[model samples]
Target: MAFRSFGSVDLSPSECYDMLVNVVTPRPIALVSTVSADGMQNLAPFSYFQLGGTSPPSLMISPTLSPEGTEKDTLVNVSATREFVVNIVTREMVEEMNITSVRVGPTEDEWKLACFTPIASDIVRPPRVAESPVHLECTVFKIIRHGDGPSASNYVIGEVVRFHVDDAMLEGQMMLAEKLHTVGRLGGDNYIDTGVPERFRLARPSTPLSRQ
Candidate 1:
């Protein structure tokens, strides 16, 4: 067998990013929405997202600073209002979600740009994407800054205050994944359709398994 390895410090930011995203494989998309202090609404999609914990029902999204070292509108609005909504991206909204990822002026409304219908959120000022099947209304629990330069990240830790799910995608209180048809991000200009027919499941071991 042969292999190649290089120190992370030796790789440029772009190269590091490429390697990370390529290997991460099908990261869940968080279509985050926020409202600026002045009431300007902002919407964006991020794949650097995951569930933090369930004790307080927390989730996190890491928004990286632009190469020019400017904060993204989503980060700016989230910092100001201390609230945002994470709308789950499904196959039906994939194109619009991609559109929202485009760079636009802070004042520009990606909701309108993507032709998405915005419905009022229950507790947060930021509206939820009506087209999305699942919406997690979150309040900022904490903001952790990693670095203060280009490609730096701001990890927004949010508590899910409320959850809104489409009735069609729900079986009582449980959400049916097959019905949701969620989409996931891959390395640049690529995405994985999780709604595809192919799927398999593995049952967890009741006790520790012996090594072969």
Candidate 2:
């Protein structure tokens, strides 16, 4: 099989990003919202998002610096206020979510452009996306920066303080994946739906017994 060694290829930052996004398969999208110190609200989608773990219900969203080497409003707001909300995007809300991905001035509001209703979060200053099926109100645990250019990343680590799930998508404590229909980010303009056709569950194996 043909293989491309990233280190040996000497790819540009954009090329590396393209390859990483394409090779990562489907990644969960985080529609993160934050409030500036002056109360300006910011919302944007980050595909480089992952769950830290369930023990403390943490989440990490890696936001890159803008082309001008400036921090994105989401990261700036998060740094100032140390709070944000992560709204899960569903298939039905893909269009609206995409609207928020547009690059706008730091003072501009994506909620207005996206036409998504912003509901007040219980503990966080940033509002949650009302159209999203799930919202996680989080407090910034830390911000770890990597690299030193426009392509550099700021890892926003947030601890989920409160979780809100739509009633129709929940059965007791379990969230129905089909009902949620969450959209995942693929390479470029591609996206995937979290439906039964693309989902499967595997039981974890128990630890091996010790040999006598």
Candidate 3:
């Protein structure tokens, strides 16, 4: 089999981004909510997200700079307030979540645009998306900037202070994946639905193969 390789240095920012989003394969979406210093709400979705750590309960979401070198409202809000809420995106909320991603002014409220019910967060100024089953109330731990200009990422490391879980989605201490109906991002105009039929479990090996 022949595989083509492209040099990173030769690719433009947009080309690199296109290659990345196409190859990453179903990245989990973080529907992040934040509030400006003036108390204006901002909501946005970022697929460049992941669990940073388990012990401290941290999440990392990377928001990239626009083509015109402008910062996103979510980044600006979180930077000023150092607080945000990460709402997990499920299949049912996908359409509304996408609506929140539309480019808008700093003062525009995405919660109203998406028609999502926002519940007052107990710890953070940003409200929790009532439509989401899991909400993580977080305070910014650190902000790491990579590169400069368009498509540059600002990695926001958030330490979760509180968690809001839908009681109905829980089975004792565990929240089953089947109940969540989580959706993930693929390439352009594509999304992955994590249905039970598409899932399988594999047990981990007790010892390394090299040791055996």
> lDDT by residue for model 3 over 1-212, one digit each (tens)?
99988899999877898999989977899999999999998899999999977889998999888877778889899999999999999878888888887777876677987899999999889999999999999999999999899889999999999988899888887887678888878777677778632432222222212210
lDDT for each of the candidates?
0.86, 0.84, 0.86
| Candidate 2: residue pairs that collide | none
Measured on C-alpha atoms, candidate 1 has an lDDT of 0.86
Tens digits of per-residue lDDT, candidate 2, 136-166, equal 9999999999988886899999999999999
Q: What does candidate 1's lDDT look like per residue over 80-190, in tens digits?
A: 999999999987777778778777777677798789999999999999999998999999999998989998989999999999999998889987877878877777767
TM-score of each: 0.91, 0.89, 0.90
Candidate 3, clashing residue pairs?
A: none
Cα-lDDT of candidate 3: 0.86
Error at 116, model 2, angstroms? 0.6
Candidate 2 lDDT for residue 191: 74
Q: Which stretches of candidate 2 lie over 4 Å from their true place?
A: 196-212
lDDT ranking, best first: 1, 3, 2
